[model samples]
Target chain A: MDHDSYSDAYLKGVLEDVRTIAVVGASDNPLRASHFVMKYLGDKGYTIIPINPGQAGKEILGHRVYAALSDLPEPPDMVDVFRNSDAAAGVVDEAIAAGARVVWLQLGVRNDDAARRAEAAGLRVVMNRCPKIEYQRLFGEIGRIGVNSNIITAKKRPVKPTKKLI
Target chain B: MSEKKSFGFETRAIHAGAAPDPTTGARQTPIYQTTSFVFDDVDEAASLFNLQKVGFIYSRLTNPTVAVLEERIANLEGGIGATATASGHAAQLMALFPLLSPGDEFIASTKLYGGSLNQFANTFPRAFGWKAVFADTDTPANVKAALTEKTKAIFVESLANPGGIVTDLEAIATIARDAGIPLIVDNTLASPYLIRPIEWGATLVVHSTTKFLSGNGTSVGGAVVDSGTFDWSKDGKYPALSGPEPGYHGLKFHETFGNLAYTIHGHAVGLRDLGPSQSPFNAFLTLNGIETLHLRMERHSTNALTVARFLESHPAVEWVSYAGLESSKYHALAQKYLPRGAGGIFTFGIKGGYDAGVKLVESVELFSHLANIGDSRSLIIHPSSTTHRQLDAEGQTAAGAGPEVIRLSIGLESADDIIADLAQALEKAVG
Candidate 1:
């Protein structure tokens, strides 16, 4: 997100302050981006609250999936908007109503009006970037696809060459 | 792949480590449940006690039935030998204990199970003064970056629990070789049926039989398998194997037992002191669990793919993150490491925000909200609150478990039924 004052550091701060994230629009499809992103983030350490109106009352990642942010047991640190640009505004409205301190839009998902509204309400706004990807990158989790490269392609490790038979 | 004597995994599962009772003609290996074995007169007893004779003198040091399970797993893993332990976590500890000592260190993957993270970050540091540093296990560079002068091992799970992210065993093994240490892989998720870390160059393998190994979850056990690939006597780096042992009256393990000494010491010293021996019942259950390992693992992978696909297509889903999916960044790695199929777990984000997520979980029908994984029945959890709750907010994000994520471990149930259950649950969540 390229908001003038909103920096990656600021987004990181929001991510840092977020003890738990309510992921709206969680999908079950293996091919969908959100499914793995949720698992990735969940694996990293965030308590992911899976939100999908279509899958309400079902558990995802062992947590209850609420239909709306208003139905959660308590206010979460951030309400991650995973819906389309069109549906994002409504989610942000609920996020504001739920007393969430931040609203993050996933990568390729942006709504200026929603960002404006969320920013206007004093909630942190991060648009078009995944917390999972950002976390890995910012925290050095994005090491080179450093497997079997036989060379230190990732993370700048010095690679020793194997001796060839004479 | 060895042509010595081929048998089906089932046949090998039962009879690999055992021999028929010569006197009674019993098919099963008898559980020698005595604490100490009686010797025939003085000479035989002296040889046995002195480690000169290859025989069992005590259950704490060795047991006939436990030995059978260890052998069977060794054969299954294509490893040289194996050691059975009280728990999977204990297996990991024993595997490294012989290679490292106080003031020494090891490099580990950050993607390790939380208990292991706790074991390395807090427990091992406090108890043994042996330090462990964690790097992002997903990337080999991070693991290499974490290495230090005192480091002796690079440890990771073949298929990390909960997330089911398969580690690049060959890559990690290469690093271990370069670092002159062992690559100890916890092969609990894939089991022997799905993938063998040893074949991929892992120096040692460990398992938690409580999970898929004991498929029905009826047992609590662990095993450590030595690939016997690393020669401890090569550079004198390992004193435990090269140096004389006071416990055994200055008998060097490599000189005496050669390839098998590591397993021998795990029993002779590790188990005896730690007293982490598995019970006969749990071992038997795990043995039974092995019978259908191949079948269960296949079904699990198929079901997981189905569930992941369903979550991806749904309007409520913001993204799906199974490596099996073409869109996943880990897809290539999964293809490289887990060619047969990726294991059964993955996570996804929900659409409506936090409250919608709470409703969705409450609406699920068949999926159990539990803290365990690799069960026959599907399991789900929101890690930020449940498993990794102790981690502060920043730690959570660093661990890949940001809030707004839900992890699912698919089960062996029919794929369609599983999807339908999630479907109705999603419908209920949104409505």
Candidate 2:
């Protein structure tokens, strides 16, 4: 798949298909962006599984934590990697072994090799992007920061009907 | 532009929120004078209204030019986000709006601007049903004693206006932290150049950009900078930020935007309803004024110290209350908070009382007898007769505006020339 060819339709399709996201290296610290993203996605009605070996048994924002992606009872629809770029490859491998359908590297965390490996293994890959920001952008939210999103209309968009896979 | 944080204060002042117009290549930020924005279609409009997207719908909420100023002030203050308002009073209202509801109380320093004192003491209680408990913040113990179950926030000024006294922000901030409330510091006098309250543990900093920020005293504007440090979700005391907001479709700001919740809520809810939004033109002027803030503040401090020293030695001068003066009670506090200088505004007591205070205002040649401060040209006012007339005699004295007191806003003039003007004025007033 062409990296630059990840169009709006493709991104939207992935977002609509994914139900549960297992976040690697999730933290309980509210100041951390990972914590915010986890809470934001969870508030948006997504099941968020926090993967932190250091805080495996503890709960963050009321979601039970897992030691690693492998420790999950079932495979997540998406594996959101919150670790640094160097640590992304290991997380991506774990996601692949867990049979996750999508591997997402959080904003500022990019690994070309990991992305390539994930795509070669028949999993979709997103790098250096945050799902919260993307959701806001695709759903027409980024305009408040003064960015031109190009899609402007006075009429409200109908909420897309959700079909729960779980 | 890319390495924004690495840039010096001066560089960031000029370039932080400003970029050349992408379409027209205009080097300056354009004043978007329109009242409302046109959406591409109904879907986009719906998304903006739903907070599903971010864009301008109406000027009553946000505007492009004001957004630039907001971003610039936020960057300069080392804050995550900012909300700009029509005036300093409006900024104060917005700053407290998201933090207080009916029957909710907040502690405020008694040493505040006369206008602010009246607003906090009377208007907030009568109009909004929010009570403001005035504490003699010269000591942190007074503030600690004022806290109750109803307390939601603590307010203070980095440098008390007219009085020229500096606050012990760290002491107050500690008290606020222990009480689980946000410490809101009015940094109008200190600005970001002289002191940053956030670095001293203040959760938020408010500024009357009309003063030193605009430097020219040209525009009436204000800003609130969120350090994004306070935990609004800690015990859910601040339901406006942590819990579901009924106004915004039951959206929880803290859970949704995290650290940026205060500013986002201020813009989305406070500004949306209050309608005290800043004009783009005012924002543009304020932004232009900010570019030279570092330079102007330094000069303002130096000139003020010279003027203060001159007044301290004058025969007709009963006393002076500039923190830069070693004899001042606030000298130690000024040293801790304002290492640069004690700012440009100070008050002096005339030996002849209120009549002489009036004479000085009428006698100054170069200084404009006005209520404004932070101008390139000098300004003088008899606060007892003008700004603080509404306050009782005791309130006037407590706020540092005694009957014999004359306030001076030192400007960027030749030190000798400014002192010469004051000498001539003092001679006439004393005689």
Candidate 3:
């Protein structure tokens, strides 16, 4: 579905009201792609509950990081899966048991079985798209390039052909 | 969110402005490119004149197209109200006019756009006898120390221009609240997609729609967003809100408009008198840009992170400062405020130094060396020679555009292509 199909009333009720999101496979390292994504979504008014067994119970982005979805204070609105495909099915099962309303896999992290299982559990499925990117795209916030340009950005230069001297 | 419960962003973007246009039953907002509106009768004109009714009387005050754009922006920005202006600078000025007067001051970050630095250092003092005390905005302590009784507000960019540095907004917002002043953030770089300054305690938000919102290098425009949380009524300093307006006889804005007082006043006073309203055409263009902002920002961030890492390892590169890169001082902060992505723009210096920097920019085929950022096509500029061309040596260094610095507004192009172009340019520069 196109982003424009999502009205503000829908966004406000379902999107903005997403109080907590458990981002599975979250990394502690600042350079890790997952780390920034969690931090960004958290900062964007969502309560990001970081999930990583390696760094479970440790604080990430000032929120109490957990090892699993079940460890969260309450069921999150979304469980954003960022793990490899091999383990996604198990993660989906965990999400179902944890009673999450939605399951989102990050770009390039896909699992059909896990997606199916989550869908069976009556959860919203968003695969292969980053929620942050989705938020901007949906809200009409994209910065377009080239199309709206009429003014030449190039300087009025004194063009001279390169000449070889004997 | 599903279609039943949740619609996509593209859907929300188009239909967020109330319903279908009543005038022509237009499903989409039509660009009403006109200067004035006519009244049905003398009494109707009198109602608009008295500020007792809501209707478009002048394009400068309100236009059908501009109103749709304003409402869309306000919704997207998570603001209660927004005012569109002719340029980003105009938006800043219009937001400030309501609060500040002669001798009144504002505290600002030194790490700002060259244009903003020039605006605060030069234009503000001369324009209104108003002055800005520049302080380092990165630290919470430094921001707090800069506050004073004379200060009317605290202004900063969501992300510093060119520098690609993220501001500590929550702390600054807290400072503004404690001091009974508004925290105004220029969210031009870290557009609402990356971070919403309003939710993070910013009382007012300003944007230069010329950059990211318009995306393409189209028309110049600016916007002011009110969070509807700042208690303007509590402050006695703002006579514009509390006192009677000469235009409207004894109608107190704070008493009447309440949360929307600034928005109404901005529409009625700032745009009405300053006549810096944004064109409907520009607003339409910006709205189109907004629809793809999220997708573009994602690609831009990924491309930037890839490019930043590539430069960090390149032999011909001196230093790169992209928040996505772990080495950047702003990386930790970037993670805090903008985890989804650290924006599309990054800055670096060439190993061959200033002359090589100049050659690299001139040699690039794919990269359009320009002043603007957040473009879909990759852009390169040796700031010392272009955007920061006017700055002296010291000022140049302070703005993160040292003699060797080459700023890159990473676009949505293939990462390999962008890298190859840079590599070839570097090779040609050194040779």
lDDT: which candidate is best?
A: 2
Summarize candidate 2's per-residue lDDT along B1-431 as a digit string, tens digits: 13122567777777666666555667787989999998766755665675644568899888878887887888788787788999999999999998889999999999999999999999999999889999999989999999999999999999988788789999999999999999999999988999999999999899899999899978999988889788898897988899887876677888666666787788888889998989999999999999899999999999999999988999999999999999999999999999999999999999999999999999999999998988988899999999999999999999999899999999998999999999999899997
Instruction: Please tell me which model should have the higher lDDT, number 2 or number 3.
Output: 2
| lDDT of candidate 1 over B221-263, digit per residue (tens) | 8998888678888878788887888887666776445455677
lDDT scores of the candidates, listed in order:
0.73, 0.85, 0.76
When candidate 2 is compared with the true two-chain complex, its DockQ is 0.09
The TM-scores, one per candidate, come to 0.68, 0.79, 0.71
Winner of 1 and 2 under TM-score: 2
- Across A1-166, the per-residue lDDT of candidate 1 in tens digits comes to 4553344457557766887889888875532456646665664567889888898998875778888898988988888777778888889999998989988887657888888888888888887666755664344222111001011111321211111211
Instruction: Report the lDDT tens digits of candidate 3 across residue range B1-431.
Output: 22344334445555444334444556555788888888766754664675544457888888767776676666667776788899988988898989888998899888888888888888989988889888888787887897778898899888887767888888888888888899999998888888889888998889898877778777788889888777777758888877777777667776555565788788888888888988889988887787777777788889999989988998888788888888989888899999889988889989878899989999999999888887888998888888887789898887787889888988888999999999899889977
Separately for all candidates shown, the number of backbone clashes (residues 3 or more apart, or on different chains) is 99, 19, 24
Give the residue spans of candidate 1 off by over 4 A: A1-166, B1-11, B28-36, B352-362, B429-431
Candidates sorted by TM-score, descending order?
2, 3, 1
Per-residue error at B258 for model 1, in Å?
1.0
Q: Give lDDT: candidate 2, residue A116.
A: 90
Q: Chain A TM-score of model 2 versus the true structure?
A: 0.88
Q: Which candidate number would show the highest DockQ if scored against the true structure? A: 2
Candidates ranked, most accurate by lDDT first: 2, 3, 1
